[model samples]
Target: MENNNFLLKINNLKTYFYLDEGILKAVDGVSFKIEKEKVLGLVGESGCGKSVTAQSILRIVPPPGKVEGKILLHQKNGSAKKEPLDLAKLDPQGKKIRSIRGKEIAMIFQEPMTSFSPLHTIGNQIMEAILLHQNVNKQEARVLAIDMLDKVGMSNPHRRIDEYPHQLSGGMRQRGMIAMALSCNPSILIADEPTTALDVTVQAQILELMKDLQAKFGMSIIYITHNLGVIAEMSEEVAVMYLGRIVEYASVDDIFDSPLHPYTKALLKSIPKVGKKAKVRLDSIKGTVPLPLDLPPGCSFYARCGQAKEGICNKDTPPLLEAKEKHWVRCFLYT
Candidate 1:
């Protein structure tokens, strides 16, 4: 059943790449929802399928990566198609997905330079998305793109739109990227580590800009990052992923205050806390993350888990179950 309140619900999603060595499960049975106008945080260490999950939703998983299960986008009230659209079912390069990609959902990549073409002006790139999605001409799209640049706090939006990606500073390039993503008025914005390339001051400004835009446009955000501090500030709910699966799902306050999974607890401990002794080293999770080429039969996190029981935890994988009200965890301890 489609919930009216949620904008998107990804059900039992699994994205796997069939490599020469073995099948690499990038996202294994991950499920989550984008609640209306809510900022949903997907946080984990690198190579934990955070980016792959976002790509799966947009149906942009590269060749040889097979994505199974439904990525349902629940339509807003009184929209053209009342029924929910399954994005995973659509052809990646087809017109249907293309129509939805920028118009209904847009993404801001980690590095703006990767997305921005050096061959074209910033305005040309921004206007491309607008012109592709909206029923507007080149002139109208240019006007809209310039207005979006201004909205994202790009200094001298009019003049800077003509500048190349290299011409602008890191922060400015990011702002231009944001301008392009918002040009089509997308309902959901997937930000994949969008601030990591910039300095802390620029990072704060970009975050604040996103918050303001989300409110102004009533947009739902899927924020993927390893920074817990950013998650705490921006997310109402968080999904803590481990080894390609969500190990814990809860409110931000619950995650920080009452982490149930051992992995979740360890992750919190690893963060540098206020008033810590200057001489002490920051805590870190022991044991390097195992390769995902051929997954173990038991829990994927079993090897690195501190509280693992030899028989129970290593024997089988634990399903993500509700350990408490609105708090779900996957671990033998909770089971």
Candidate 2:
């Protein structure tokens, strides 16, 4: 059931990839929702299906992989009261999804160097995006692209529009990517590790820019990142993932102040506090994530969880149960 208050609601989404070795369950039974104009931070370690989840939402899973389950998007707030569309059932290459992808839902990928085409100028790429979704002439699209560039803090927007991806610095390239993603004025933005390769200062600047843009556009955002600091700074709500499932979901303050899952606790403990003693070693979660091809039948975190019990955690996979008001944790400890 799609809630009218939610702009996007994902119900038990399972994206799996079939390979010569075996089936890789990249995203298994994940469900969440993004309210209108709210930022939801998806935090997890590498290979935790965060990126795959985002790609599945946009129907961009590559060949050999298939996405299952409901991804209901509520098309409210526009001129017409359009019916709720199930993105999971839509054809990936069909015109309907294509029109919805850029115009309604946009994404900022991790690496800008690879995201931009080396052959085309920045202006051409952005203008093409605008022309694809909106009914605009080339000249009008060029002007809009330049305006977007200027809004994203690009210096000499007219000159920068003609520049190639390699011509700009790392920060500038990221800003250009943001500009392109926002050019279509999407209703929802998926940011997947947008500050991965930037320096600390530039990372702050980019984060600030995203906040400013979100306020200006009043768009809902799904911010995917491993950095707890970034999550604390950018998100109003937080969902912590392990393996391919969400282990904990709660408000940002509750996540940091009263996390229920062991995995979430370990992640928070790993972050170094600003005024803490310098000589103290940072805490780390023991054991690595199990291989996706051979996932255990019980709790996926059983091998790594220090609080795992013999008969409970090792024998049964706990469902995500509500422990507090709007706080859900997938663990027997909470149940």
Best by lDDT: 2
Error of 2 at 208 (Å): 0.3
Clashes of each: 0, 0
lDDT of 1 by residue, 1-335 (tens): 23556689899999999999999988899999987799999988878899999999888899799899989897544363477889999999899888888878899998999999999999999998888878999999888988999999988888998889999999999999988998888889999989888877788889999999999999999998777778887889999998889999999999999999988888787653322321113255567666688776788888888788998888899999999999999998987
What is the lDDT for 290 in model 2?
A: 69
For model 2, the stretches where C-alpha displacement exceeds 4 angstroms are 1-3, 76-82, 272-283
- The positional error of residue 7 in candidate 1, measured at the CA in angstroms, is 0.9
Please estimate how well model 1 matches the true structure, expressed as its whole-model Cα lDDT.
0.86
Q: Give the TM-score of candidate 2.
A: 0.95
